[model samples]
Target: MTRITAVWTARDDLAAMLAALNVDGDQCRYVGGAVRDALLGIEAADIDIATRLHPEEVMARLETAGLRTVPTGLAHGTVTAVLPNGPVEITTLRRDVATDGRHAEVAFTDDWREDAARRDFTINALFADPATLEVTDYFGGLADLDARLVRFIGDAGARILEDHLRILRYFRFHARFGGAADADALAACTTHADRLKALSRERIARELLLLLGSADPLAAAQLMADCGIWRVILPETAPDGLAQLEILLAREGQTGALPEALLRLAALLPTDPLLADTVAARLRLSKTQRLALGRYATPWPTSGTARQIAAEVQPADSVAPWLLLRAPDAMVSEGLKSLEGWQAPQFPLGGRDILALGVHAGPAVAKVLGEIRQRWIAEDFPEADRVRQIASEVAQSAG
Candidate 1:
């Protein structure tokens, strides 16, 4: 009988939709992460709703009530209600008729208890009726959430078999909750760890990054290694990657830097650019992510202002000193500084300037300009006057 509420529920936009969905009596409730997070005092980014109304009726009521709706997954009895606060995925209550460890064929039902039973974890099954703002815990979701425990709803193995990705989700949720993991869940995840290969590379990569982005993923990562999950998934994992990850985490904590999943991933992999490329390709990572991983693996120059290195490396954000904190002599001092005022200084002299300095407008002019630019960086990026002087000297020398 826990009473759960959040500012989102009381928002004008949400109130209008709530009224629309409940016009036929109590049919919709705030569900999933929003309800779970409201109780935990964490702001949820997404709001989901579980409704007893059928998908078609749900859409009709929303449209009739002047709310925009998207058929996000009507086959699965789900509709997306777009509100000013955010788009809420309103799913008609359903029970899985069959599951194949990847997709589930669900039959729509009006029973909330059956809906709750179909969910993966106990803590995720909690719901709150918008009519009364009272939480409805069909299982022991309230107690589990209070204990910060992530327990499977019915049977752990059954849940894992139902969705192979649940193997990774167990560790991800466990790491996020930061509590003593459920032994049964842990065991189940380990037993079916190979099932992770059945999942898409994109899904595996996403879950791994989210896990890495946790406040402290060290223990969960070590647990994954112990369960042989890492071996099956990332064979190229550095033997010292976990230790280096701990070091990078410590450095991040000391510098008050937010966790970066790609950078953290770089810490967990052998610092080989080729290996980075290979692993990134296996994970189906974006080009930017792959390139950043390679740069993080490739050690930046041990000596240079962040600005100077950034100038040469182009996208200095990816090769930030801190991302290279694992490099030998990673210029720890420079890593300690902030990039707040950092800007890649523009080269003062150009090919035109060299031509004006009595150099012919051809390959020779470009040649002199290149020389002056190198001198400018070598001289620690002096003023324009210094650059023009350097340009004159280079042009004369070229002539």
Candidate 2:
């Protein structure tokens, strides 16, 4: 327990904002993720404050202090105070009065314990006074934090009822924090698996992409499968793809070097382009991402009939080479290295040169230019007469 004061903190501006709110340091605490992450010596992404002030009072003091404020969800008694470090989400202490298995009807209160009890997990419920740096542990979140456990704050079923997103969040947090299901958490997640359907496809897409991008995503994914949550959200992804994903993940850690989530997802799903496209559209992936995924699903098949058929059904040659040559497995780095000693060729012929050869200004001129360019790349652009010969042959064939 490091006893520290606000003035000695890195969040000096945040401290100043709370002070301007005329908030009693004794009543408000720097709570949730910031405190838990700090204890683990990891950088916190967001700051949340649990305050004794009513939402209206908090907003008033913020305005008086010259800080811009937004009542992000005043009905739920939460306010957003944008500070220099980041947006600080301040919420009045509250407890749930009723839940519809998707959202909760809450009543504001002044009890930190009651507020903590309403959170999703114990590790997430830890609170600390950043000024004094004193932690308040009502549910032994510090212990769970040290153990990398993802324990629910109270009844998992009740928590799931309040917000069904917790079912996916449970697995995501476990992948990040490293934990196993308590019997209750696992059971409730299975029971409420169908509730995930009510979540917007965009929301589910975001969470699933994050999960697939994690270092040990397979662990959480396996847990989801075991709990029957996989079938509800993404039943189209083949089990074979999951197995391939595991192998790919083992070779690649979640660092700056890992492949994109869409690519990995492509490796996991069906090889059929139509099925892949359908899945990508269903997840609402961006157009570019969906196109890239389609490429992954139907890789460069070297010998199959599909390969021959696709080759016979040709696209424009110039663009096709550019796309196919840059496939994900392309040894681009090595190829670039090999090109270090190589130099490119300047075309010996131009449209004027072709026109001099009696080529008309119609499609033949463009066709002649393209033939010369391909010969340049293929023959490393030898002498002028050699390219001219190839171009002349191509023009004769076209005529």
Candidate 3:
């Protein structure tokens, strides 16, 4: 048994919580993703535990040990114990009584094997004793972990039928963990591709973004497209810009910057404003994300002139130039790259400045100020003296 020596085990708060909950190390054990990630030498975010004790018993024992307990999901036999380090979730062992492709009705059990069998994947079913550091694998999760295989715990089709979201999860896990899709798992996902439509739009969108943000999502994304999964969720779009995505990712890597999710998402979309709006509304994207999508869809100026590029650029929409630079035209791409150092210069003159120049505070004054600003931009943002001269000329003519 490979012992996990992650920093989580050495935390004093965790040791206190474990000592408080364990009554000889047979009743409670750390389980699920935390165990799996620890074994793989990855930093686990959330620590979860499974125990034979009932929810009420777990609460009583923790409170007696002077630990704060929250009934996060009592109906599901789960309780959260708050410690100084962080909150650790403790759930009673459970076996599925019934499932409806989306939710499961579970019965609390004391059998560890039953709990392990009820999980989705073999890698996620392993358990570790917090006190003894003993990892118990009912399934062959250790071997699967060693091989970097993301196989379903039991029958792939049966597990997926229990919850169709697992189809997306199958690809998501592959993208993050570095593995080829399990043959049976991929086949199950392909057969159930249409079932993804039955899922809530928010759920589908969330899963899709996470999958896209993974370390290497190209293969998983292509697989999703090939299996018709993309058609069900994003029927209007396809993985057509994968080559552009590869280029963008490589460039981002060279700069040592994290890849932006929205940029990657844009690679999958068609440059049509109406279609972008529809997709944004369908996914219920936030206002900022919608605006970025809008910028991507709006056509950019084809002229490679500095004035033309400056006219199209806005401070809030700076990412637009980067997205447009990926265009097939070499001249257009070069023009955008040249404007990398260009900042939206503050207009030296304002409406008030025009009004003070003997111009009345009305639409005429506003028009003069606008004209002066345009002149400044057209001249590649000349010095303050040139801007003042232009503003004065416009103000005098309007007055």
Candidate 4:
């Protein structure tokens, strides 16, 4: 038997936990993304541990060892062990008892093979015992990770039926892995496309956004569309719209991608309030994001020289120029133009100023005050003399 060793040299934390687990001299390793990413030479963010000990046993031993334990997902046989290094998520090996394409009923067992079978993909199913730093590969996860391929543990269609979200996950993992999607898996995803509608809008929106914000979003999106998953996920999008989206994606291809959901939506659907409102409501976007989407659907001055536009229209000085440029309407810029550095000159020309200028304080004062403010924005607030000149013209017109 070939022994598998973890690529990372440092993991005293894993050793401590293994001792606490009563594994004594037995193997416990850091598994999943950390091990896979280490092998791939990418930075791993979180460390996950899969132990041969059952959930209840692991919890008892950790608590006995004086470690704070949180049953983050006890139903699924997972516990969070907060240690000095970091919070390590330790889950008992389990197999799915039942799945409704949305949620699952799991049964915990001591068999690592059963646990590996429950994972979404082969690359993710790998585990390492952190203490001795030995990797346990039950499904050839190490080889798949080396090939940069994402394959289901057993059958693709079966996996999709078990969790509809996996459809989106497939695309997201493919984009992140920077690898071509498997042809058979892609076909299975297409066959089960309608199951995606069973997923919540929030889940679909989140996964789709994550996929879009990836390095090769266009490729992932194109794959989704070709596989028939895009139609099920975003029923409103049309082929012509996707073409336009491809152009936008290419424009944003270099780096620092912003997942402007509204801008992306606009490329497919017309600037219609119904479309924008429906998407915002379904996706439950933040107030700021919703407002940005609404602005995109409305009419705005998108064409013309930058100088003709108001300087305030650019952004709040704190906002990105790309965001302002992507806004549906140029109202942001228009608002800036109106509010620029000019703000009615403190109304040194107010109702009081107007009455002192021999103007009555009735509706006439209001009219004169309004006129002065407009003049300020139009003439760039020349001075109080210019304000008074405009005020008098308004009082004369009213007379």
Candidate 5:
């Protein structure tokens, strides 16, 4: 008899919604991720409800109780009851009638076991009574959860065949929850890796990014590559840079900064600007993300002094990728720390300043300004007076 008592379950809004739906002893319970996360002592991000009542009845009861209801997924027997805390998706128990690997045709059911059997994994199929904190495990989800194993509810291949996206979801879940891949599950994922092409690029990108964003995605990423799953989705990339990722994660932890998903993704890529362009196009990353990745992929100078290169690269975003690529290098680490308060020195001479120096307003003035700026940067940006004197000399020579 496993029980979960968590803030999500004890919320008054949730209790009220459950009470409204459970009028006359109608069964409704918290299901899926909420139950699993609560039992694991992680704060549940969303609360989903499975009910014996049909979708219409669930909607009618909630509406009559003065709670807002949205027919968010009515065709799939789901309705959302919006509460102050967050939206609670109330869905009638369902069994799959047909599945074409991408979409499913489901039939509503009253039997909880039927619904549990159709779920992707055993650990995600557990249900908990909102009122009594009692959990119903038709399958051995509790045992699997205790062992930190993510196994399919029944046949691994059959479950994956129902929705190929579950293949990535399998790895994503393992990354967050800390589990080794079930043998059968890994085999099924590898066999059906090609089916991932049928999924929309947006869908594939979303799942892959989520996997990459997990607490420790390196192991799952390596497994995906070894099994050809990585090739199916992102053949141009490799997991060879995972060691750099570990270092970047450690640095982020030390600084108390939120982990940047794009940075982690960049760590997995080769330092080739062309590959970054291809990946950005393939993943349809946002404009900002693409720019960051493009800068990250730019090759750092291997020959220059650290300070010289650091002065050349001013934007923190530009320097961050190089530092991450060369993480734990004492020189690179020191350069990164030095950049904390450093601002790029402004060029002392502009086109107007050149003009004031008797240099005619033309390409020669621009050329002389450029040369003086180069000297300034090379000299590590000397005092403004010295730079101005140097600029004046260059401008006079050009004139």
Candidate 6:
């Protein structure tokens, strides 16, 4: 009697949508990650519905029931019902008509098991009766869930051939929930490791980032390297990168740093700025993300105090994660402590101030300002009076 009725019934939309869909028959069930997460006592973030109704019929009925529906992926048989909280995606049951590793041409079906069979992992295929909260598992998903194993739905090799992205998804789920990597699934991913080349870099990056964001990606990550999957797909990162990530993860917990994915990603790479840019471009990261990762790729400042370091980078506390990644624990503690309730004190003397000191409009103004700047930073960004004094002395010295 595995039930999530009390949990999901609290959401306003689920009950209404279930009522609408079950009007003629029991046509819809909560499916995929929502069901798996609910059963695991994790709050389901994304609610997906599986239905025997065709795509058009589902949309029609939802609208007729006064639920607004969006044809999110009509070809893939998905409609999104808007809720006050968030969107719930309702998808018609589908079977693969054809697939080429990267893409699947699917056809709507009335069979729930057929839909379940077409999914990637057993734990992902579990469906729950929204009314009774009874879980229907045609593929032993409940057993696998209880065992904490992330096994593929059918033959691992065959399932991967249907969608190559499943190779990455397999490791991701394994990292998140598996007791141990399923041997066949791991082997299949290794065998089809080359097929990962066929996937767009964007797809590969998305999965890798998600995997890196997992509770303990290092387990699955080390496995990938051992299986030669890493060398095949991402040669930019060597096996040693995992060692760095291990340290970074510990530092994150130690320093109270949020385990952010991109920041973790920066920690996962060698401290090579050029390589970070290459990887960022390869993944087609946004301009801001590319810059952030690239900036964090350099080694942390070794010579300065935390305030000085923070003053140098200025504006953003971008150095915190990298400091955690590279520096010793003592330095990390001091650096993080220095940053808390810290604002980047505005460096008081601009070139204009130097110019106003009659250092001239040319390179001498720049030169005196450079000296003042060094002293200002070395002095931990002093007040404007101190800066003006430094500027006056530097200008006088320059003359």
Going through the candidates in the order shown, the clash numbers are 0, 0, 0, 9, 0, 0
- lDDT per residue, candidate 6, 1-399, as tens digits? 677643665777677877888898789988989889988888777889998988788888888998898889998999998876789898989999999999999998889899999999999998888777898998988889989999998899999999999998988998989897799998898889999999999999899889988877878888888777778667888447888888888887776777767877887678898999998999988887887788778887669887777776732656776677777677988888887888877666677787788877888877787788889989888888888888888888888
TM-score of each: 0.94, 0.79, 0.87, 0.76, 0.87, 0.96
lDDT of 3 by residue, 252-334 (tens): 56444465666677667776768878888898888777777766666555544544455546534444344442444444445
Off by over 4 Å in 6: none
Q: Compute the lDDT for candidate 4.
A: 0.69
Cα error, candidate 5, residue 345 (Å): 6.5
Tens digit of per-residue lDDT, candidate 4, span 60-171? 8888878888899988878899888778888776789999999999887777778778888888877655544456788887777777788877899999999999989989
True lDDT of residue 381, candidate 3:
81
Per-residue CA lDDT of candidate 5, range 205-313, in tens? 7898888788778788777876788778877675567666777677767655456677777777787878988898888887777777877777766655455566666
Rank order (by TM-score, best first): 6, 1, 3, 5, 2, 4
| lDDT (0 to 1) per candidate | 0.83, 0.73, 0.79, 0.69, 0.82, 0.84
Relative to the true structure, candidate 4 reaches a TM of: 0.76
The segments of candidate 5 whose C-alpha lies over 4 angstroms from its true place after superposition are 239-258, 303-318, 326-328, 340-351, 364-387
**Candidate 2 lDDT by residue in tens digits, 187-239:** 99999999999988888888888777766677787788899987888888787
TM-score of 6: 0.96
Superposed on all Cα atoms, the candidates' RMSDs to the truth, in angstroms, are 2.0, 5.8, 3.3, 5.4, 3.1, 1.6
State in Å the error of residue 234, model 1: 1.8
Scored by TM-score, the top model is 6
Runs in model 4 lying further than 4 Å from the true structure:
1-15, 25-27, 253-269, 296-300, 303-399
Cα deviation at 140, candidate 5, in Å, is 0.8
**Higher TM-score: candidate 2 or 3?**
3
The alpha-carbon lDDT assigned to residue 110 of candidate 2 equals 85
Instruction: Write one digit per residue (lDDT tens) for candidate 1, span 1-399.
Output: 688857787788988998898887989888888999999888888999999999899899999998999999999998999998788899999999999898999999889999999898999999898878899898898989879898999899999998988887888888888488788988888899888888889999998999888888888898888888998888898999999889888887776777898888888888688999999999999988888888888865656666666667745677554344554444654544645557668887666777688888788877777788777887878999888788778777787
The pairs that clash in candidate 6 are none
